[model samples]
Target: MSALLDEIFDVAGSVVLVTGAGSGIGRTIAETLAACGATVIGADRDEDRLGEIKDTQGVEPVHLDVADAGAVDNVVNSIVENHGRLDVVFANAGIARGGGLTTPQGTIDAFDLTAWHELLDVNVHGVVHTVRAAARPMKRQASGSIVVTASTAGLRADPLVSYSYVVAKAGVVNLVRQAALDLARWQVRVNAIAPGPFKTNIGGGGPIDPAVEARWGSTVALGRMGETRELRGLALLLASNASSFMTGCVYPVDGGALLQSLSLDPAE
Candidate 1:
C-alpha cells in the first residue's frame, strides 16, 4: 500500500520552480515541495522573504521579479542549465491593490488606473512570462506540470477584492485553459488552482483584522478563512503523479466559498 501510494504521489528528485516564494500561498507551496524531496528553486523579488527559506533542506533561493519577462526567461534558463530539467513549475506570483466595487475607490468611475496597471503587470503578465518560459523546456522534455495560482474571484465576481485583482485572475483562468490545450500535444500539463479567501499576505502583509476576517469567512460554507497549510495536499497532488490524468483543470480549494452568493454592499 505504501509503495503504491509512493508511486502515485512521487515527486522526489524532481527539479521544481515556484515563483512568489516569499510569503503566503507561494511560500507554503515551495516549502511543501521541498519537504517532499523535490529540488525546489524558490524565487521571489523580495530578498528578505527569500532569505527566510535559504537554509531549508531542499530549497534554493533566488531573486526574481516575475513581472520582468527577460528576468523570468533568464531564471528558467539558468535552472534548466543547472538542473538539466524542470519537472514542475508554480507560476504563483501575484499582488492585490485598491479596493473592490464595495468601496468608493473600487467603483468603476473612481478606479485607479495606475494601481490597475501595476497589479496587472505582476498578476497577469507575470503569469504569462512564467508559463511561456517554463513551456519551452517542458515541451522539450515532453513531460512537465505547470500549476497557476488563480482565485475564486476569477471564477466569479466578488466585491471583497479589487477590480484589477478580479480581472487579472479571470484572465489567467482562461490562459490556463488555452495553454493546456496548446501544450497537451507535447504532454505538458497546465492547470490552475483557484483558491478562496485564505489568510495570506496578499493584502499588503500584516495580520488580518478580525472583523474583516469574519466578513470574508462569512462567504464560505465552512465559515472560516483557510490557513496556508491547508493548501498543501492539493498542491502536492497537482505537482505529483497523483493527478496524471488531470490537465487544463481549474481546481478550487475554497472551503465551499463558491456555494454562497456575495452581496455588492460591504455592509451586507
Candidate 2:
C-alpha cells in the first residue's frame, strides 16, 4: 500500500505552474506542490502577494495577469522554454463581484453590466487564456495535467454567490470536458476542481465574522467552512499520477455542500 501510494502520488521533479498563486486556494496549491518536491512556478497579478512566497523552498514567483492572453502565453512559453516541459498547469485566477440575487445588484434586471464584464474578463477569459496557453506545451509533450478551479456554484445554483461567478465557473466546467476530449489523443489530461466555500480572499481578503461563517457553514453538511489546507489533498490528487486515468471530470471538494439545497440569504 505504501509503495502503491508513493508510486501514484509521486510528484517529485514535476514542473508545475499555478496561477492566482498570490492568495487563497491557488497559494495553498502552489505551496503544497512545492513541498511535495515539484518545481512550482506561481504566477499572479499581485507582485506583493507573489513576494510573500518568492523565497519558499521550491516556489518561484512570477507576476502575471491571466486575463491577458499575451501575458499568459509569454509566461507559459518562457517556462516551457527554460524547463523543456510543462507538467501541470492550474488555471485558478478568478474574481467574485455582486452578491446573490437577494441583493439588488445581483438580480438579473438590476445586475450591473460593468461588474459582469469585469468579472467575466478575469473569471472566464482568464481561464480560457491559461488553458489555451498551457495546452500548447502539454500537447507537445503529449502528457500533462491541467486543473481549473471551478465552483459548486457552477454545478448548481447558490444564492450566496454572484451571478458572474456562477456563469464563469459553469463555462469552465464544460471547457474542461471539451479540452479533455481535444487533448486526450496527445495524452494530456484536463479537469476542474469544483470547490465549496473555503476561507479565502476571493470577494475580499479577510476573515469572516462568526455569524457569516455560520451562515455559510450551515449550507455544508459538514457544519463548517473549510480551511484552505483541506483542499491540498484533492489538488495534489488531480495534479499527480494518482489520477492518471481521470480527465474531463469535475471533482467537488466542497464539504458536502452540494449534497443538499444551499442555505441562501433572504432575497431582498
Candidate 3:
C-alpha cells in the first residue's frame, strides 16, 4: 500500500516554481511541495515574507514580481538553466484590491479604475507571464504540470470580493482551458485551483474580525473558511503524477462554498 501510494503521488526530485510564495495559499503550496521532497523555488516580491521560509529545507527563496513579463521570463529561464528542468509551476501570485458590489465603493458606477488595473496586472497578466514563461521550457521537455490559482469567485458571481478579482479569476479560468489545449500536444498539462474563502493574506494580510470570519464562513456549506494547510492535499495531487490524467480542469478546495447560495441582503 505504501509503495503504491508513493508510486501514484511521488513528486520527489521534481523541480518546481511557486509564485506568491510569501503568504497565503502560495506559501502553503510551496512548503507542502518542498516537504514532499520536491526542490521548490519559492518566489515572491516581499523579501520579508520570503525570509520567513528561507531556511526551510528544499525551498530556495527568490524575489520575484510576477507582473513583470521580463522578470518572470528571466526567473523561469534561470530555473531551467540551473535545475535542468522545471517539472511543475504554480502560478499562484495574486492580489485582491478595491471593493465588490456589497460595498458602496464596489458598485459599478463607483468602480475604481486604478484598483482594477493594479489588480488585473498581477492577477490576470501575471498569470499570463508565468504561463508563457513556464510553457517554453515545458514544451522543450514535453512534460510538465502548470497549476494556476484561480478563485471560486471566478466560477460564479460573489458580491463579497472585488470586481477586479472576479474578472481576473474568470479570465484565468478560460485562459487555463486555452493554454491546456494549446499545450496538450506536447504532453504538458494546465489546470486551475478555484479556491473559495481560504484564510489568507490576500485581503490585506491582517487578522480577520471574528464577525467577518463568521460571515465569510457562512457563505460555504461547511460553515467555515479553509486553512491554508487544507489546500495541501489537492495542491500536491495536482503537482504530482497522481493527477496525470487531469488537465485543463478547475478544482475547488472551497470547503463546499459553491454548494449554497450567497444572500445579497446586506443586513444579514
Model 1 Cα shift for residue 61 (angstroms): 0.6
Q: Higher-lDDT candidate among 1 and 2?
A: 1
Give candidate 2's error at residue 115 in angstroms: 1.1
C-alpha lDDT (0 to 100) for residue 167 of candidate 3: 91
User: What Cα-based lDDT does every candidate model obtain?
Assistant: 0.94, 0.91, 0.93
Model 2, 1-268: lDDT tens per residue?
9988878899999999999999999999999999999999999998889999988889999999988999999999999988899999999998888878667777778888888999999999999999999999888888999999999999988888888889999999999999999999999999999999888888777778877788788888898988989988889998899889999999998889999786545421
Candidate 3 lDDT (Cα, 0 to 1): 0.93
Best by lDDT: 1
lDDT (10s digit) by residue, model 1, range 143-193: 999999999999998898888999999999999999999999999999999
Which regions of candidate 1 are displaced past 4 Å?
none
Regions of candidate 2 where Cα sits further than 4 Å from its true position: none
